[model samples]
Target: MKITSQNKLLLPVFCSAFLLSGCWLDSDDDKAVEPVELATSANVRVVHASPDAPTVDIIIGGTPISQKLDLDYQDATAWYAIAPNTYEISVEANLPGDDANVLTFSPALVGSQTYTILAIGSVGQGTLEALVVENTLTPVTAGNVRAQIVHAAPNAPEVDVYVTAPDTLLSAEQPLATLAYKGFTGQVEVPAGDYQIRITPAGSTTVVFDSGTLALAAGSDLLISATQNVVTGSSPVSLVVATGAGSATILDKDTPAEIRAVHAVADAPAVDIIANNALTLFDGAPFKGATSYIEVAAGDYLIDVAADADNSIVVIDDAAITLTAGMRYTAIANNTLALIDLDLIIDTPRKIATAAQVRIFHASQATPNVDIYVTADGEITDVSPAFSDVPYATGALAETGYVQLPAGDYVVTVTPTGTKTEAIETGVLSLAAGEIYTAFAVDGDMEGAAPQLILLDGFVVPQAN
Candidate 1:
């Protein structure tokens, strides 16, 4: 009787029976019993594809397979080997005072196969999911390599991918493949060499993403992916390349910064905020009004607030502002025209799962030192100040540290210290879970112009002002 690969399952049972029987065998009989080969182990690699999800730790079978793995946006992990078996995979967000798994999956891996488990979709939008792909790692022709591309960018549209030489102009080149969200391409063979990758809209010449340069070794198998770029404010798509042997690398493309303009000066007229005194960034912003967040390339600009969009009659002149990548900023045309100035505040909001983060900014030069009260709406008279004795100009910009509060409707009031008799700026604000907020007290002399609270939904634009 011959033992083939299909009959290999019975070999374990046959060996167990032979072990139980204490039969004395000759040395020649022992030589006749050949060793049975078992199935090869499987290879698995993890990719963090969630755009806004924080750094995560990958856990397998109740134990952490990757510890403190800082897989930021578009990051991938090297491949790991495991015996062909079922596994309980879990992904936990590396947040303070939290060890809860954000996602979990149970998969049974097969022998001599490769698998990629990806964490995809948005975390706050409740669309997060884990996607598994069975990878093909068969060797290609000599001096050539096999590569595939996976599109995992949840917010991106159908895109064309281009692999070319370094410094190649995208407008003059053709795409290698066109893929939609969650789409995967079959393995394509190419000569092993140095190459660059670019992504553009389908049938368009505009390049949306670029991977400077990468080297592909001969006989290597590669898996490239398009993922969400969280660092960029507009959530542009980025890329991650993984080898068949499990090594992964992220090729980040330049993304725009986020910014919004706020007309906080009560006495100033309606104006247009211009970048570099030429390009109109915010048009026709009225007093106490704020524009929606706009995306721009990360760089320095001379921001000028003009009375009109024609760049004539500048109200706030030549305010130098530097915009950094992956950051959110608010340019406020604050104070009266006599004391007209620009206040640039860097807004970095950290959202908790169950609560909202609130911060206070004192932008009103006329308002005296006051206490800030954040209490349940209609309960301001019964509660004390949340932030007490907050001075109007403490060194640089008067701002309070973030305070986490339960998500609900709350009333914010600005009053003189030790007395809540006359609230200068009082307004009702509704805070939602997993969001951050900033309340700015604006306007000069209560007698000249009534003080009001300009509420900013912190990281984005103002929901209401």
Candidate 2:
């Protein structure tokens, strides 16, 4: 299908290129011509715009034009050349046991033109569709830059965009363009300099998005897109600033920190974690239990552990902790109720492809400096301490850096440093490929409260292919 302009205007003519082994269609006279005599082809690229869709392969006329192409959200393929004709384009899942075509469409292409075939909308939600946009490569005026805005957010409403001087208020400015979902703006030229970009609902003064300050250089051609954000769970939508010739950057609306709470206090009762003495993060968390990581704006927070879910009875007083952006942390309630302390551990989430990462936390006040061993489930006698001389209190020897091990089921045993007798033995812990975990040595109250091993799940960092 032809890409119609927002104003319903026809596109102008541009230069053409070479054709391959397919039929050619002359748009000027509406006539089909032989492929042998035609020398013009179209410059086209495919984009994976569906946020939740799997990486896909592009097929044309039942031929696999792009194979095993794994395009995550917002990924685009390099330009390809094809003879101008009306051809059937299909998208198939790039996964095993599921080679079904997700979508198919026929679009009339013209010779010597440029087009972008975008797979938009959500997968399986019945909104999946492909959009064809013809691109104009006309050079911008000297000392000026060109840009176009694409609205690809599947769940977002129609919006109005503003590009103004840095820190300009959206309420005081007019939108440069108003666009609907999947709609795009025509290439607009602007003076190359620093400017801020904002997006809001159509005809509303409330600002829903903002790009602080961006430096658009002279002669640069940019494609700024609003898309679903898979990272930074704090925001549903984010901006991706891509150039026609270079790399792209995700302008996250807000940087967030991932944090979890752990109850490691041996003798203390279940508690609730309160932040800023007002918000209850966790309720009735039992001893040795760990909560799943939660995302929050990066900053310093006054943290406290209360005896009640309502945070009415205070146990551990306000403890100030600063969490950095894009980092993972665990706030452990350690020591005894008499001491009532907290320890913050920065957990590294980077993933290793061939092995699992394991770290040890010494939370048991009853256990002395110990040596830890990890071996195949039944081969505890064959392996040595992965970590040695780990102390009891929250100090230099209280925790160990992550150590990598082959993925499998393993038996972990803790012993007084230099001894072979196991002070505590974890029955059997399974470490999966590319996973990260923390093993906490908790109070095994021999007198009815047994000392035990607790495992806390950690984040797995994505690996580059």
Candidate 3:
């Protein structure tokens, strides 16, 4: 079926001529008005049916719009319209018990006013048209990625899909270009680097998209296509992961130098540093170019070298040292061995009372100040609601006193005040009426380090009637 997009431009043109006193009036008297109206362009739609299928929401620009008609049968009417021009369309359907399918389309629409109806059953999957107005294929350079929707199934099921950074799981901040297409195929242009290709389809919780990594180089085009998605739970959703091509890597950081020579004891493994995964082994190399350093839990580690040579040497802050939490260290290497500098710190968790004496510990390292807010659900046997404050300072941990709050989902946020240059991090801690929970905030800034959260199980004293 066909749908017509209203022409917003013509209404103003006709009104302007009427006010001008006969510009369009002369033409109107010379010719008869056309009874049949034609569409300037058309938008494609998808008809999907699955008990667990999600409801799709279309977006024009950044505004939320309606869903495509769910034509479960071939004869069901389903279609969309576009006003001849370039547009960015996004389709998303995220709901509980429904598979998540978010896709987009970037097509140049024409002004001929016609219906470009696409049969739904033939292409089982939905179709997203990048309507080319003048029959011209827009030249997409390397390092640029574009999504294309190819509904290959006539009566096939619908799946979920999204374009994001490989391994990182989130979309890249400075992506070359992002547009929507129908199928799982997409093109991304990037400088030479190692990157993971992520594609998540409907019905899957985690990133069931693609697992293969990308090693993109300058002026190179990469194609990604997914066959299926990773299935989870008891539902039958089509989950497909994208596939990667060529030698493209998402370059995050330089490889750490070898630590074998400096290690008087154990050798270090070939270090692969993942973003936000926490601290890793020290290779005894200077961390001069790294954007951020890793923070490992307080412990001992074995260091090794990426490569070893004769009489090679490495330098570090110290020969061997035990480290704690919330610290930064550097590494340096020469010929054969790499040296590492270890920075250690201890972030403490706050203590709170459950009932009367039970306590739970939480890390507030990357938090600024912890605020305790309360709500009561009528389960407490006592009413001791006093609090203490502990302030965090430079080179020292800030301690805030504590306060008692009634049970419920209490929002605890660390609001930094006074010469403090940090953003607040908020959390919801559910206290079981009489149960106790100790929570605090650390520093979200790099200098302050991310806050630590600890939970110590506690119980409340039973009340006597």
lDDT of 2 by residue, 122-182 (tens): 7646688887778643555666767788888888888988989887877778898998888
Candidate 1 per-residue lDDT, tens place, 1-465, comes to 000011111111111111112222222222222112233767777887876676688887777766337565555666666788899989887653455589988899888777888888888888888988885434456666567888998889998999887778777877898988888887787876667778888888677776555555555556777887644444366566665333333333355567887877777777888888578887788877887678788777887788854557777677777776556677777767766778777776335454577888877767777788776764567787777777655234477866766677877777877887555645466787677787778875344665677776753465332
Query: Which of candidates 1 and 2 is the stronger one according to lDDT?
Result: 1
**Candidate 1 displacement at residue 446 in angstroms:** 3.9
How accurate locally, in lDDT, is each candidate?
Answer: 0.67, 0.66, 0.29
**Cα RMSD (Å) per model?**
16.7, 14.6, 25.1
Better of 1 and 3 by lDDT: 1
Name the weakest run of 10 consecutive residues (lDDT summed) in model 1: 1-10
Say what the RMSD of model 3 is.
25.1
Cα lDDT tens digits, model 3, 196-247, are 4332334443443332343323332222222121111112222111111111
Please estimate how well model 2 matches the true structure, expressed as its whole-model Cα lDDT.
0.66
**TM agreement with the true structure for every prediction:** 0.61, 0.54, 0.19
- List candidate 2 segments past 4 Å from native: 1-41, 60-68, 245-249, 261-288, 296-465
The positional error of residue 238 in candidate 3, measured at the CA in angstroms, is 17
